[model samples]
Target: MKKQLFISIAAFGILLSTGCTKLNETVLDESSAGGLTDKQAAESMIVPVYATLPNLFTHTNYFALNEISTDEAILPYRGGTDWGDNGIYIAMHTHNYTSTDPNLRNTWNLIFQGISRSLTAITTLPGINDASAKTFLAEARAMRAYYSMLTLDMFGLIFVKEDPTALSEIKRGSEAYDYILNEFLAAEPDLSSDVTHGRMSKQAVWGLLARLYLNAAVYKNLYAGQFTFAGEDMDKVIEYCDKVINSGRYELSPEYFAIFNDNNDTNKEIVFAVDQRADLNGHNRMAYFSLSGDQFPLPEFVGANGTDGPAITPDYYRTWENAYAPEDPKVDPRFYKENLSIYSNANDTCVPAANFYINRGILRGQQYGLIRRNGVFLKCANGNMLVGKLFHDTRNRPTLPVDFTEKVDFSVEGSNYPSGYRVEKYEFSRKSASGRNFGEANIVIVRLADIYLMRAEAKLRKSGDAAGALADVNLVRASRTARTPAPPALSNMDLDLLFRERGFELYWEMLRRSDMIRFGKYEGTWTEKTDANPQKRIFPIPQTAIDAASNLPGYLVQNPGY
Candidate 1:
């Protein structure tokens, strides 16, 4: 049963660097998974597999691949031995990572270990025979394929074995892609066509396959060359989108905030999410990292408790000037929240007070020491959600004193704030620090919004209908802008505009590196600009793994040019 809690247990390791084996150990053994009974062992096993979802690429996953690759976020801690060890490599991609730290073993272990878990379930889950067991098996298979796809996407290789104890048998580059795809194709018939939102079903698998194929050209090229999507591949992408759209099982959620809020898991638009339970199993700092109390609004919202991790480069912020968009200030409410929203739904109206924080700077980025009203600034400030929360147990700030336990409202823009924006993606602890079940929020893995955008990209590129693609892009973007009286729209249809729209819509959602690679932007220079090395797009295989397998001559050739 514990093994089945993969996705759910992420909360415990939100900031975990390594050694999470026992933390996520599968408790459900032979009988717990409805074992050999032929009853529903398969179904029971599936639960544990899905439980690993949110944990897959969250803290370790995002930093290893997503944050390093994307524009809006970056790894902040330096000289640490925890996660994201490829700090120098990260800066090479973005040209900003400056540490000469040891090679990143966190991502290497997390992904590999996580995949190993998926393999364990995939190999063992089929033995069950109950309805839930069957559903779980299908979902686990789909999930296993999903993890395999990412392994291929990021590193170009994967350990193809499912037996947890099996010796490593590396599948290289494109061959790995082929292996993962085969699993997906095999899974198609097994998965449920039902729409279970956060849980995997047939439709979710379809969307993931579509995603892999949509980027087939890149996968086939092994992150080395530019490859075009074959017509058949394009057809495959559209085919999957058709199933999801036609199935009527899922739809886009109407409100922007609701999509990521505490209540979002129930939203109609969610196809798959990393489920988070307040007291149950959860992902810890991901949702909370990007925010701060100074920027968070209202009573409990006044002063953020943690160090805000990263900020938008003024230059990156300006990339919003996609000629196709409307006036900047008039953009959608999502822009406000996504780009900048300071308040949590703490008081509904009164806003949160300053004191009820998890302890500012534990996740602190820039703690403000001064606040004064300026004629130039607005009396009431708003937060930008685009540059979402970034705090993570700051070594700089201390914990709270005894008296200021609840809400203490005051105003001071976080100096670390992006153009004075705050994030509300993760909920502030209901009780600043009660020691357990404090803040629980889902980490969305694949969602309808992402699929819609992916489809938009494929449609625009495949069909060469810029306006039509813009429509799809804007379809998702429009929902994010309701708070603004005059919302932004694609002003001119172009690649640059499309990229900006993607940024506006999907900032810090953990797709930066891949998006940059797909658009040929990963190698380009930006603020804190680093000249991109083509070899750096995909990280070098962790040295530890290489050391563990000394027999293979070419196993550690290094990613082309170390």
Candidate 2:
């Protein structure tokens, strides 16, 4: 089932790059899709619904809006030229973004595109009489719920339509939240329990339900003082998480990095993921985005310059540093401590002379990597890759020692560009012949580790089961300790401790914004952000969407803050 979706993604990417998707074209040819056999029609109808996923989860879309907006990452203008698209990134981090931000507008449109496609499938797929027809219908509805939930979570509104030509009504707050929850519930019965991880299976539905229930209070009231996790909601979260856990289909990955590798489809830890492939339409942006122009990861490909876009915040980095003993920071397996060295030969075969190949987790301190000079890679006397000091893209800037630091000077113009550390959470693809342009790494959307964490959190919040919560947390910690030294186990648990534990386990996974809001820290001042307006809890509906919806009477409403 997943292979079929992968094939669709490959075909979709080719057509998408050529500007031939129905969302871009003049019209949808229902005859071609409708005239197919039952099996063929089912596949055709589901393509559009899955097609919008790449645009939604790609580096610049959902990941940028969610992670960069939080303290986990930031995309400052390197050398005051690159990544300086009218300060949109800064606006996101600072919470000053308006409805006119182009990136924000793009995300808004892409999400609706998914919702629109899903709605089309819900009405079209039910007409087939094949055995797969019911499963396809349920999957379509589940897709709609998934997309709608994201729209609601981010914009505080969802669009509802009865059929392809029907009008859409804007649902808000608890109304929109409840509608999405019920949609998932309605689809659960018919959803295939044994579908591939990438498809909408009963497990995926349960994971989505657990997530929705976990954040029920926040969705019920957009901005509230001290959210109360309703007992029933918390219980539901536990129940659904248990359902996923007890299924025995997933287990904690012994290697933390294995969960995000290119071969992660067979890792057995991922419950839901975006099936990206190098030969198909996979992305190298996640691992390549933050690297400097001088660093090269692959020996087979050249001229692969990273965008130097997003970097980890010092505040988040301090959390990891402060948790462990300073003498040996790499003792914790999640930190990827063994390979890092303050010095490098620069002539080594590794992409980054610093030996960052296949390494995962946060990066800090002096970085060693091959430096590009005079439009060619600098080489050592023995024909080994020479280590040259990195300099700003701007001419005559001070030479960089490849030293990554925690503090970044976001306001410096053209200088101090390489001050922040780069994230290597996703495995760098050494097999791609296209270098950083394409990759084969599968991006895990949800995994067993997350399910365990959610259940542990629910147990702690619903009942004072600190011991039970600690056991779950330890399970995750122990699973990753097979190759690296394990941290001492905690005797007790608290909300603050649990929150920090989540930072260690789930950073850079696009969960920071929601987590911060649930923890009541979203409004608090951090780094570049201020004004903490309660109205900023949910982004303003894009002005473009609002203007387009104005064609129909009372069809759309802008969010509270623009």
Candidate 3:
């Protein structure tokens, strides 16, 4: 487990500013350096790759396209006034977004930035003549492959470069897919098997390979519904998943929430993650991103208030209700609910009387928490902390109950501030009031539970082995070595059951987009989304990208139905 202090990703950005150019940029300084050591140059070369990861899921990037675009989550226009960013969020959910959508372009640019950095490393790192340089080069290729996979998955096109000076050729469909596969396979032997959560290690490579192979059919066929998970691809998925599982390196965390805590960097279950910390470029948004304005978690920490951002769709929440008797989330280990909880910033038990902490995970029903009255926490006459209905706005005059009711009005004018269930999948950092921005929790990318689920899906899809698939699912359920009070074991499994199970296990982790596409559910109706156009399955090439490519003649083109 590499600690946050080990690398200065900020310095990498500074160096990258000097390195970001066409492959034609002269690799002058390092190639004939008389000052910097070979290892120092190699270190400098690899930092930009890490630099690209933290922002991938931040705010309106890939996470928006993955979760908000699906039935899992939504970012409606709050109060019919805020969050109305030209109706882009609604358009994203409705499948009506155009090439000019800001989030789409931001996601595209961020991913390409990663590709460009990885290409720089791949082309520049080999100038050194040390054994470690080989490892660096392999990691560069692996990082490039990962970025390319995202581009290929999101848009049907990828930029292929032969050498530094050569113009990039845009490859699409199976050709680009095969190129990505080759990159991963080529990097495998040279990658270290060490548990570097932030870096591209052997286990991360295996996990990436499994993910790519699992989605191979969708990548191959693009929008076609006849995407057959080839026997060979399914075998590769199983093979790679086994590599990660059998490595004796990771396991399911005993406390499900432990995997998302501030100390998650030490969790063995995380195979690959984005390292976030107070000292590094960590974002605290995940912890407070979903909570409503009235449900404050850290009243002691100054400026600790919910931004009232995205929330889970009622449809996705119904998955839990449908699974459990009486629909009580407190009975499930996966759902973290806190009621009658008191919180103060900085552990000052005298926490000024006005604040209270809301429990994490999905919040529903009549919400209960503390409120600020005259800069002091309020209390009941009986000496217990005061609890009341969560209000909507900052003024607390509108009197909005925190009861997350179904049947949200999807229209801009009809969208309410407290319409959906808020999620705290990533543990809220109690370390600071402004913890949302300075969060230290490592954002999990790949983990042991996901590996088990992948293997189960592959087994079920490839050989019709329902018993084998059920056993794998049961392993994840029963092996709550880290989480106590395990959820009930699932039996009598089928395809639909497995699909719902995956939702319960991996929701809000950026897996919903590909999973829905693979399950042929991407186009299904839910909430405000009704468009099922197959072309929308793959995002359109941002118009800016197409226009930029036009300068090179036939180098770039848009995906179908853009």
Best-fitting candidate, measured by TM-score?
Answer: 2
Model 3 per-residue lDDT tens digits across residues 212-308: 9999988988868677889899999999999998999997877777788777888888998887755454664777777766665654543555776
Q: Would you list the rank order by lDDT, best first?
A: 3, 2, 1
In order of listing, the candidates' clash counts read 97, 4, 15
RMSD to true structure for each model, in Å: 9.0, 5.0, 6.0
The model with the greater lDDT, 2 or 3, is 3
Question: For candidate 3, what is the TM-score?
Answer: 0.88
- Cα error, residue 247 of model 1, in Å, equals 1.7
Better by lDDT, candidate 2 or 1: 2
Q: Model 2: residues >4 Å from true position, as ranges?
A: 1-35, 337-358, 373-398, 413-415, 431-433
Model 3 has an lDDT value of: 0.75
> What TM-score does candidate 2 reach?
0.89
The sequence of per-residue lDDT tens digits that candidate 2 reaches over residues 1-562 is 4344334334434334421222111222333433345665566656567667666777888888889888788878776667888988888888888999887888988888888777767776666657777887888899899999999889988888876677777788899988999999999999877756767789989999999999999999987878988989989999999999999899887777778776676788888776665543566367777776555665445665566768888777777878775645467777763342324444344334334453356666665555565666766666655544455542345455556667764668322567687777776676666668665676777789899999998998998789999999888888885675666677788777888888888888889889888888888776666667877778878888888878776778777767
- Runs of candidate 1 with Cα error greater than 4 angstroms are 1-44, 75-103, 162-168, 223-225, 293-304, 321-326, 338-424, 429-439, 480-486
Candidate 1: count the clashes.
Answer: 97
Give the least accurate 10-residue stretch of model 3, judged by summed lDDT: 19-28
lDDT of 1 by residue, 1-562 (tens): 4344433234323323221111122323322422233342343344445555545545434543566445565333321322233445345335433212233455566566556556656665554345555555666667777777766776677776656676667776568778878888887786666544656677777888888887787887855656576777877887887777778877665556566665555777777666665533454555445543223322322343433334444445556534325665324554443322233332222112242222221121233221212211122244311222222223322332111111111112212122223334455444333312234455566677777777777776787767767777767766554455434565557666677666765666677677778878877765445666776667666666667667877655555545
